[model samples]
Target: MNTETTNTERSTQIMHTEKQIEFDKIKNIWKNLAITDYAKECIQNTEICLDEVELRNRLRDTTNSKEMIEKLGTPPFQNITEIRDIMAIGQKGDCLTPYQLERVERVLVVVERLRDYLSRGKQFYNSLAYYDENLDALPELREEINMKIRNDGVDDRATDRLFDIRSKMISVEESMKQKAEQTIRNNKECMADTYYTLRNGRVCVPVKKDYRYKIQGSVIDKSSTGSTYFVEPAGVAKQYEELALLKIEEENEVYNILYTLTAMVIYAIPVMEENMRMIEKLDFIFSKGKLSVDLDCVEPQINLERKIELTKARHPLMDKSISVPLDFKIGETERGIVITGPNTGGKTVAIKTVMLNAYMAQCGLHVSCKAANISMNSNYLCDIGDGQNISENLSTYSAHIKNVLEILKEVNKDSFVIMDELGSGTDPAEGMGIATAILEELRKSNANFLVTTHYPEVKEYADKTEGIINARMTFDKETLKPTYRMVIGEAGESCAFYIADRLGMPKEMLENAVTAAYGKGAISNYKFKNDNLKKKEVKNVIIKKRKYHKDTKLSTLYTIGDSVMVFPDKKIGIVCEPVNEKGVLRVQVADKKIYINHKRVKLLVKSEELYPEDYDFSIVFDSVENRKIKHDLDRKYTDEVYHYDIEK
Candidate 1:
């Protein structure tokens, strides 16, 4: 029997990654838990002389049945007697002693002889009673013999011979098994029902309840009542007395056996520890299972429900209690989101939500999503929040610039990038100008990027430029707390005066500050500029890029004229289009249509058109090989290149 299949796989299959960690934590807390499992395995593996449940009963045998219930919680079996009759002695509330067991053994010898004689006669007696046509008792043979001899009133030789045989049987009867006879050599009839012996060649018989008569003998004893007798034959009487003590000795041996068995309970301590550890792990897994986020809306659906999916993703440090569930998918034509919101509005969490979920999915735990449908870039670049290095005496704006510079060096056309607080910690004019410039460079670089910023200038860039969009986190002035919700196509309203007034600032001072900054016209100009930027919206380049991508794919598919898969990142397609060159189908794809690979493509045919052995559908990806290439400047950048060739 493969215990491994049921016991090992079942125990491990219930655990997720987090649950495994939880189990480790529990082991640290209680080391003995591992031992508990080992103990259980030991019991299970022990030789089963009895049935499993019966063996369990024997192992738990005890004199005090009440203590059994208290300690083990439940008896391993219903009644210990079901496994053996010894349990009955315990039920009588009198513990068996060794002396009693020895006595029983001696008594059983006599019982055994009687049982053997009856066994031999049983078949014949049963046949006479059941097999005959007329079942009747045997005729009176003794009376017939006596009557025959008496009726003749003569000296009958045959009658005389029978009487002689009967008288000799009492004096000369013997057993062939001398050893068995010797064990019961001291023959005593203490009573018609009970027997007792003494050293004085005396035996007592109890003829009436609680009344006894003694018999004394020279080599043999006769009762005073003459109803029962005894025999004393030297050492035989002492041997017989020892036989009577056998039952008690055996009972004591049984108690010793059980005492040794109970010592094995020490092994159970570890088993309980291990069980407790596993229990705690189970608790943690179930606790995570209890999270009820709005993941249903993000369930992966085929083409019609196509969207970016970030399942059960969260800010790694935020406790589960304060965590907010954020879900959004860009509709068709809504790429390049611009998140604009007040401070502490969960902007950072939202950004991390996207990044960490992608990382987690790559590592292969089923994402926290009800369903996940995602289109991913082959590469990713992140320019998240960075604080200025005081040791270098660098300002925040300088640090931000250095981070963006590093980001620009690595980003490619097929990369996804996230930038937090895109322009900040510098002169307002300079920061806004640099922010718009960076967006322009990113747009031309052909990378999908997300940027968060407070600058109105950055928002204006989104409205005026193609392949860009604006978004904002919602705020409630009445509550003065961020709702942590995003609304697309809107810029965050900076309500400085309103907040100052709510915070118990003098109303007159707030009014004066607002008038000094705005003069009513500055505020009007702000709205006008925003409205103008919306009017100046240009054709989004991402829409054009998607259209071109769709066209390229359609063209390649058309050329092949048969079903195939496209690796868009590498701009390659494996065609079933047969050609004379090497007599193999040519893989044709475009370099500009980046990321399509031969590994991504497959030969498709109707099931009825192929046999099981006809085709191998497994696709193998090529290992990247470094190739040094010459540039116009005679300098070379070592490029890791990959190419595919059909094996069959």
Candidate 2:
């Protein structure tokens, strides 16, 4: 029951599978639910567990987290990026800043709160409590960090020398300020601006430049023009020197305190790392539980018997209000399902739903379903959309055939494969032939598979083959629309004639299409009424041709493709569609085609005189982009067209 893959090979396959099923969209949802970037990374890097024990443990943890969240509120694991960055710096033998030490204490406090929160329900939520034990709050270090650092600075209580030095600084600073004020009062006449100011952390008095040496110990500062000078008296100078020495002592003591705190943080780094990992694991588990709740998902039964039964399963990525729920099964008497339906039906979605649920279940996530029973698979292989690679020079058919060949090589009973519109993008007869052959091979391999196709021949093969079931997305014949509801054990008709008739195609054309498809009306033509179209109908009538009024009508004056200038507007245009007998000529002006009386327009150039005998006028009439796209399709096959919905 162990299916764990190893190293780069497994990683490549996991990413490939994710791309095929668009698992990143679901992964995005899971990542956003997490509180911390660490938990988001855990979701981004995790792969599906194929081993029974590993898979079950993941599911069990998620289940326990969900129950714990509902009963005991969410665990408080706040996002703490600073904790990791500071720890890294501490590891490099660098002393942490006071701010970083404070952040460390904050994280530790949260860890302690989370630990106590989970421990309360240990007897009932033991699985959740396991992670709680891994969270080492380190209360002793937490208390130490908080006590030493307060408000992003070393507190006085941090060290006795720091306290004593700071007290001395305050007293020296007061005494220096008093001495500065007294000197300013005595030298009022010699002062330049009459103020005592601090320069380089020393008290100085502004003095007139002419009286610089009158009362001074040292010049501390001067004005830009040399009109004024600053001096500190010798009496205050000695006391100022003592104050500076005490300030240096205070700085040294603060550095010592910070060094000791940094060492303590470094010592606790290992335990903090363990605590972070535990928090991330818990965050990741809670995110899964939150997704289950947000999507209203259910945890399904898992077994190793290769049997999958889903009742009312939904595609998690789709809008539940509009999308139809799928009811499907496989890996039992029938290991393969061949889905046949009209284009744009829910065939591809239904197949993807089955594969996505199995993939999620293997990842230990809940399935978006009312209820289900699923099995572990060694691999989830799929080729759901067009795999065309222009750089690789692979056509749609070539890409599909290559993917099928690779799938054939890897599939076994323990594998689950979903193929959408297989054997498409090629000749219908050849595609159906290959589709049937691949289905037969899959049946023989005993691998559970779901494939959708529009080929009737493949449907017939599924109908007659043993251990293969035929399903179809239901169609409404009256409305000519697909119901998008899958019905098992039924072969669906293409209903091409019904759809054509509904779209206003002539009855004769529908009959011709029916004859060509079913061999001369092998099946009855669908019944449709012209009256049900609910529009006005004209009855057949005959009339004589209009009599010529020679004087009343304007004579034809321009040939088709001749450029003409219309009167009044002075706009030039190209003449198109020949001038009618009544002298009304069709002309193209820019992108619009207009009809004007020939008398109001005069030909500027003759069709024969402009260029050659048979020039293509559409070059001027058609857009440049359209001409370019047409040229591309003419040279080689391509799906890109200027306006596909209009032209085709």
Best model number under lDDT? 2
Candidate 2 residue lDDT tens string, 1-648: 345545665677678778778777889988888999988888898777879998888887777777777778777878866678889999999888899999999999999999887887697846677666678888898888888899999998787888888888888888888887888798888888767898877788888998888886799889899998888877789888899899899889888889998998888888989888777778888988887877778887899888999999989998889878888887778898999888887888888888888888889898999898999999988887888889999998898898888889888988898898978887555677889999999999898999999888898899999989999899888877777889888987787777777788765555544543444445364675442444444442221122236664444456677766675465778887667877677787766788876755655566776659778765766767778888898899888756622311
Q: Give the residue spans of candidate 1 off by over 4 A.
A: 1-317, 368-372, 390-394, 506-512, 515-519, 522-648
Whole-model lDDT per candidate? 0.43, 0.80
lDDT of 1 by residue, 1-648 (tens): 599886664344223211211322222322322123332332223221213344223222211222222333221111111212332443354443333332222222322332333234335442211212221111232223233223322112334444443334322222212322442333223334433344352332223322222323223544676654444433444444554454355434444533322232222224323423333332222112111111112222222222355444444335556776666554246446788888898676576566444332322212344455444444455666665689999877787798688678767665656778887776555677888888888877766677788887788889888777888888777767888877667777665655665666554444434434434334333311112122333332110001125334333332233333342232324343433323234454432122232323443332223324444332212212311122212454444333333332
Q: What RMSD does each model have against the real structure?
A: 29.7, 15.9
Work out how many backbone clashes candidate 2 has: 0
Judged by TM-score, which candidate is best?
Answer: 2
lDDT of 1 at 274: 40
TM-score of each: 0.35, 0.77
